[model samples]
Target: MSSLFTPLTLGSITIPNRIGMSALTRNRSTGTVPNEIMLKYYVQRAKGGAGLIGLNGPNVLGFGIKFRSKAGGKLPTLSMKLEVKFMLSFGIVSLTLIPVFLRPIIMLAAGVPVYAPSAIAAQGGRFRLLPGEPGYVTPTEIADPTPLIAQFKQAAINAKEAGFDGVEFHGANGYLVHQFLDSTSNHRTDQWGGSPENRARFALETLKELIAVWGPDVSLKLSPAGGYNDMGMPLQDTIDTFGYLLREVDNMGLSYVALVRFDEEDDGPRGTAHDVVETFRPFLTKTALFVNSSVTPAEGEELVKSGKAAGVFMGMNWLTHPDVARRIKEGKELDNAPDFKSFYGRGRC
Candidate 1:
């Protein structure tokens, strides 16, 4: 039997197969709400064979994420000029005042708790999540998660309410959570900044709350080698920050840690971090380590044997072959792989 097709248990969740789905951006949110298409898409994947699928935006709600989409679904090809325009008028200093302004509004609107790492607009854009195709939002301004955390918590509650298994925090994409972790993007001397440890403070605290509400079956997704929006940090810094975060969360008994791996080792930490996979590899001691990104079956098996990884994840390949797990198990040939170009929006052949 193909180990890839095997069933495994992480924390309290027992997935039927090892072929888990990684989060793919599918521009399908209202900046505040998920559209019907988004729900349908995930439900489709769940029915198809995905053990878990990470929700994009609400995963990381902070100022570091850049939502280039305007009031329409069109995302601006951002250059320094546009940001300068927005900053020169009001300046980013006042951007820091956003949370204060939004707090009262959220309290009045949702009557629930709210939280964020910084007072900036952020998003975790799923690739192909643009409009006019088959997704949700047409792209607009980035929404602050501070006021929306309660809503996301409610969304998680709703997911639970709807009978979904569990939720994974999307911290890897160049979203708010990632924005806070990478130092180059976080210069604030506040609690969320000062050092890598401090930057991870918000995520840690947020995890606590998530566990309080959702239990320990939650998972977390992260990529150490990304450069996005305002969040920037050297490889060494990311290693230090993520390493610390894994230890902290491990103690909390989080379910799984999905480390999005890359090929090149140049990411200061090692070109998109493959060279230094070892540094971050140790953090998975308490939980299962899910390494993904262009990984072949042989390499995955090696990692498991070498004690470098727990399981492997295939993102794009799983799109077309929703039954990939069953096929791999029975040794049947995989059907056509989905073209990356068609993975976005709602259209597919």
Candidate 2:
């Protein structure tokens, strides 16, 4: 039997198949709402055979780009409302929001400054930052975790209103939650920074708030040794920090914990350590765990069989091959050779 086609339970929800779509940011939202193009794109993927679709929360505010309607601006709003409702009715998508990243996008949309855990700058050119420029604008340092915690809680409540089956907090990728987890990025003297428990305070508190509103259906994504967006914590510190995090969330009964780690053989900084997923798998005693990377169908099956991951997540593959699950199931070749120029919004594809 193909592990990819097997059913898996995520918290109280049972996914029809283990093949799920990882969140993909297409930069196609109107400011805070998904456009018709975005709707069509996801609908295609759903029809193509994905069991679960994780919609990228474009900004921290949980708003996408503003809806630009051709029919007096009402069409896009109506389209999005209908689309979200329709997708939920299909019972196959998880809407997610990344705290710091989405907050920056929200602030930018409102013509205001963005904020993070600390004032540290991002490695240039990752998103919109120049080689030597800060990746964010007027990045405010979060001294108190109260306001942000409330904001995230409210966001979770709002997501429930939007008909999302679940919400995933983007704790990976050097966002606010991640910045707190990384000792080097968080240089505060408050309870939110400094020691491991202190650094973990913001995330745990915020997650607690979210759970209050959203319960066990909420999920978290993490990159234990994240180097993206100018993140570089001590390797040992990274392991220890994430170890603590997994243990804390273990009994929370979260829907799932998604780890974005390197493949088995990649020699990146975190790659040299033990497999992040396998090393941390024991900590997730109750929570469902999955890993996302350039994993092949064969490798995914092995990971599931070896009790490493409950399932696997695919990203870019879904971009070009919307029916990636079906293709993998049938042993058919995938068609996702994306043109780099088009991918970077520099081409007329």
Candidate 3:
């Protein structure tokens, strides 16, 4: 039998199969609320036999209150009255003061302008935002990280209320989380910047908040070698930051760490995703590791059997093959290829 079909446990949650779904954004949201289309899309994957599914965005740069529908459902909209009540129930102060009191720690200090780890801006002309879709802007450097931290905590609350089995913090692909980790991007002199350990601080703190609310089952997705958003850290820095980040995560007793691997010649992580996994797999004393990105089923099974990874995830393939797990188990052929035009919900009938 395929090892992909074997049961596995990630932190407190046990999944029936080793094959799960990766977060892929389907631009089907209406405003910041998930519409009926996304509901059907995920339901189909679950019924087709996905053990788990990760939705994207709620980028912390936007203070967690800002919604980005790049690869996940819109955070369910709760009315202001309900939001305030929810905060009160948790013993938190009124929602209105969240920004005022929870502002980034650095931003509140004297002589510090609000900025990111570095003052670098995100590159443009990559992809156009849809109508009503918020445009991507360069993040301001932060003096006060507390507000962003609170936003992340709120995102955790939103996720729990959304009834997901787990949530993967989108720290990869030049998003806000990755911005803090990249040296070229995070050029601050304070505690949140400089050195591998300092750069990893934001990611670690965010993990703590997530684990506090979501339990230990939270997964952090990372792409250390990623060059998106003009993000490309020195190779050794990438290695050191991720190595330290994994150890911190392992100590936190989190469910797992998901890696976005690339090919041998790919520039995302110095080497291929496989090499990245091999590099950091040893430091993970207690944490499960999940590998994804262009991984074939046979290769995934090998990674599991070899004990390098607990499971494998497929993102793009699952779009056309909802029954991908079953097909891999039976060695059946996959469905037709996904149309590139259909990915953005553009140029389609």
The number of the candidate with the highest TM-score is: 2
Write candidate 1's Cα lDDT for 1-349 as tens digits: 3455456776666665556666554546544244556545555555555544444442223211222212222111111211100000000111112232334322224432222344344332232323332321122222343443454455455444333355676666455567667665455676668787888875776677667766866777777766433333566777788889988888888777777765443123322443436767676677888887766656766776665766666776666665555555566665585665555334431
- Candidates' TM-scores? 0.66, 0.81, 0.78
lDDT of 1 at 202: 58
Superposed by TM-score, candidate 3 places the C-alpha of residue 111 at a distance from the truth, in angstroms, of 23
Measure candidate 2: CA RMSD.
Answer: 6.1
| Alpha carbon deviation, residue 335, candidate 1 (Å) | 7.4
TM-score of 1: 0.66
- Cα displacement (Å) at residue 239, model 3: 1.3
Residue by residue across 229-283, what tens digits does model 3's lDDT show? 4567666777888889888888888778888775443344433233678778887
Compute the lDDT for candidate 2.
0.65
Give the least accurate 10-residue stretch of model 3, judged by summed lDDT: 84-93
RMSD of each: 12.6, 6.1, 8.9
Q: lDDT of candidate 3 vs native?
A: 0.63
Give Cα-based local distance difference scores for all models: 0.53, 0.65, 0.63
Clash totals in order: 19, 11, 26
